[model samples]
Target: MDYDGILNRKPFSTAKDEKKLMYGEWLTELTDYHRKHCHSYGQLLKHLMIPEHSHMGEEEIPMLPVGLFKDMDLISIPGNKVFKTMTSSGTKGQTVSRIYLDRDTANYQQRALANIGGDFWGEERLPLLVLDSPDVLKNRNLFSARGAGILGFSIFSSRICYGLDQDMNLDTERIQQFLDRYTGKRILIFGFTYIIWKYFYQALAKSVQKLDLSEGILIHGGGFKKLEDQSVSAHEFKERIREVSSIKEIHNYYGMAEQTGSIYMECPKGHLHASLYSDIITRRGKDFSVCSHGEKGIIQVLSPLALSYPGHSILTEDEGIILGEDDCPCGRLGKYFKVLGRIHQAEIRGCSDTYDG
Candidate 1:
């Protein structure tokens, strides 16, 4: 498909308020078309055969988790057009798989970043301080930290990386140098939680130079899986970052390689809002019963941008509660939800292994 032309069909350039209308209608129409085209989806729809009228009920979009990406013939593009494959970092079973991403995937990823992240970063060229390992991008492991941001998000900017230290540590010298060089501008500091905490938080605690919070955004996520093991609460992480940097607007986004087109942005109140491109619903308790607003359950996410893959509305392993609707005081609209935590013993056999969705 000529994705460039499809994306350029007047979606992003329109007025800001129209995004939800355009995105919602387009997603619904796209999924209706997508359900008929993709094989796995077609099979699922045929097997269970949800009524034609029950389309927007947040049904699980038939997606083979990253682990099964190896086992199935999941490619949707013509075989000759297949480009790069992005894998996940998780326990590698005998059957491991990589997500086949065509140029369209890159296009979708770039557009989504520009539309959403652009709202946060704005037009100013912020000197970036990437608090991550240099080697993370070099190798091609599924859990490869470095490649994730570069491929999924950071390519949207031109700023360079101030990676880990010479002793393979979180190099404060490099970050400091970048900060010193790029003073008087809002900085963009990106890293996974543990690394950012270990490096910057530890440094701040030790009386190192504090981050200028008045001028920046700290975009970090790699799940709280490993971070919580260190006894760091989400509040503490935010507080410490605030204390060290002094930035009030700290956004923590959540996404996956399975469906990289949409990112769930965290509002200041600590709830992640579903983007215009996707919507979510939760199942109450252990029963897969669709819960009402403010009820806790599993998050089923739906996005229509996947062509090379099928990740429509997927049942995630995380349990969360929908706090409210588009009435956020923070100016971010749409269905807002708080991720309570990951469901225990949720046997999701795949590379994308965060139950806390």
Candidate 2:
């Protein structure tokens, strides 16, 4: 679907009309491809009486309930061609979504991640400090979403250091060593939100000694429901981290294992933005109709990269408000929105939520 061509374009620079037209054509093609190859998805389409020659706008496209992934092994590719299998971090005793990818699709995912991440990290690799224990990465093939996140971003690492020791305690000496060795260099810090807060930030607050991370770019995501339960807002999260570590640049991304690699990244102005290859739609909870800017509703994410599976148009359990399109104060094109949080008990999913008991 000319994924490379789409990913290579400026992430935040496409015109609204042009990008919409492009996404409509490609997404419609993907709808047909999945309908032909994936039996379960085809049944879903047929049951809904969606015609074979349906010419629907991107907003009118059918959306699968993301929970379907947990209940079925939905893949468009043959078993032997399945390159990798990724599982979502569903709550205990609950089912996790399994996403299948062929080699080409896997490579496309990585390239898409690299392109979007490049917007923030720039062209060069930086010294990376991961906020979790090294043990999480021991299994090279199987991964919890947290582990996959570390490995994905590690592609931009010149050198990598794990911040927590094996016991899930902050490894002061190890982290200090990395900072001391790469003193004054611009480093990248990655971790799930709660881990960075409970293990990293809380540890720093308790310690008499402080380490300087002033020259670092801290990127974290997963879910913030746990934090919200504790009365911590994103603003408070960033402010607390700054107070303890002196790191001014903190970016929080919104992504899921169901739609890996096609993340919505938070910009300088605190809004999560869609890149060139993907888009987001906020739909009214009552009718599933598209919502206007500033109206809160369920989130339906659209990505061309999900064609390998039946996930091209997924109605996620998340709720958010579409702030604007193509005219952010941060100057990024496409939709910019704020995640209001999860809808009910949607299984504490995402990378950060993986560690919860």
Clashes of each: 10, 0
Per-residue lDDT over 44-133 for candidate 1, one digit per residue giving the tens place of the 0 to 100 score: 667776444343423433333333555565656666666666654454443444566677765785686666666666745556667655
Q: Please, what are the lDDT tens digits per residue for candidate 2 over residues 164-229? A: 988889988988889999898899999999889889999999999787899999999887887888
lDDT, candidate 1, residue 287? 65
> Candidate 2 — number of clashing residue pairs?
0
Scored against the true structure, residue 6 in model 2 reaches a CA lDDT of 77
Stretches > 4 Å off in candidate 2: 348-351
Error of 2 at 229 (Å): 0.9
lDDT of 1: 0.62
Lowest lDDT sum, 10 consecutive residues, model 1, at 348-357
lDDT of each: 0.62, 0.87
Model 2 earns a TM-score of 0.97
